[model samples]
Target: MEGQAKGLLKLINEKGIHRNTKFLAIASGKGGVGKTNFAVNLAYILANDFDKKVLLIDADMGMANVHILVNVNTKKTLKDILNGERIEDIIFTTRNFDVLPGFSGIDAINEIDDSAVYKLVQNLNDISENYDFVLIDTSAGIDNKVISFIRASSKTYVLTTPEPTAIMDAYALIKSMKKLYDYSNFKIVVNMVKNEDEGIETFERLRSSIKKFLDIDVQLAGVIPLTKNLQKTVKKKQIISEVYPSDKFVLHLKKIAASEVGEPAPEIKEGFWDRVVSFLRKEG
Candidate 1:
């Protein structure tokens, strides 16, 4: 099945692998934020609609389930790559994209070391050279594994919902990441929204919280509304965008993807210190 999927991707494009690749890391502060769902559908849309060569790296490592979500069986995973295995042995194809499956089973994830992380990043960088985009589906929660994937990527997205806990955790994750690297390339996506106004409200609240406490600015890439078909698609192991192309939810997601891949991120303005000083001076 995996090989057949690869053949499909190859048939979609006769030119073989692409040389320019963009890495987009999908991350969240906690589990159950639908990060994987977003990653899966986004990759599918890029592959099907945009006809781009995409590689979905299930960087969630220990708890990787991108394959399960899509109901595809992978023969090899990153476990072999970390154990002195050649990278070529682990790459597989999906229905619409290529996937570098994460490690599975028996302490494979727990045994990962700095050397493994380095090699993983290096291998990913090399693979990116041959694809149009590499969508990294990072593990939920603020673990070292998640951080490694997010920090290594060229772009990172923080996903949140209208739920209070989810929003707070998302903010926390953003704050923690900012401590390690510049958050300029970070963007937000509010998922499972009830309506457009609810989505905007959620974004505004989260943005305000970050601006107030962390004094960091974030861009809202877009929002995904909660639709019944989302669950149906997941149950069927299909992408909402593909199964229901005409669905409003899918259309909005396509728009988000278009903006995401169509342009480079705008330059982030001013350092946190500058923002703090400005606020203090204004108050005085």
Candidate 2:
């Protein structure tokens, strides 16, 4: 076992795969928190505003909406890739970034086998290094699928709203994940807030609960205000930073993207791919 571990590490170092791509999984404990919207806009900002190569993978296996919001029509998705299509073949490119769209309303897609998950990661491994950041928009809640993706990411952003239910569910997610995965790198993003104060209060509430029980310190990544324009942009299928560049929400998103929450991309450890493979193996 020791020899095999060393061999795996050696191969990982030699390949140096995914060394330039910083994988960030944008996730939420419950649905309807605008997590997918955040993922899409963040990808656009990173690519257009910061001039970085971004690959936004719509990993919401059950109800994927990234492609819909981005107004990109795709006949093939990550589902096709899972069914033997090359990952490169399924990607749909836009002016902002490349999108690996996921299947929507497909039960089988949601129930992907462990081997298929391994293959999916393996295929992504081939091209992931080409980007500066790979943001995975994950399905809501703390299920096995969600946990698997979050575990593989360099950083996991736990998004939530100010509602008490949302806060509790987000806390529950972190609590559940803490037992099985590393919660140290988890960051909080409070969305749909009236102002920064509300966002901070929500984060503090969730952070206090987590620190009190899990004894894990979670960072406040950013706070997105409740803006009607964001909804309009979603309806129009337009990138917020493009159409409403001067909007407050857009400004906040730009700030978040320019800050450590995004820029000065994190260093990818030499054994990063090895860790991803190990996580998949354990899941399998």
For this target, which candidate reaches the highest TM-score against the unseen true structure? 2
| Quality of model 1 by C-alpha lDDT | 0.75
RMSD of each: 10.3, 6.3
Report clashes for each candidate as comma-separated counts: 0, 0
TM-score of each: 0.79, 0.85
Q: Local error of candidate 2 at 168, Å?
A: 0.5
**lDDT of each residue in 1-284, candidate 2, tens digit only:** 99999999888866764356788998888899989888888898888888888899887877888999989888898778678999888998886699999876434533677688678767777778777788999988976454666777778888999999989889888888888775556889889999889999899999898999999989988999888888888888987778888888878878778884445666655534456556555654
CA lDDT scores, all candidates in order: 0.75, 0.81
Q: CA lDDT of 216 in candidate 1?
A: 81
After superposition, the stretches of candidate 1 with alpha carbons farther than 4 Å from their true spots are: 1-18, 104-122, 182-184, 265-284
Work out how many backbone clashes candidate 2 has: 0
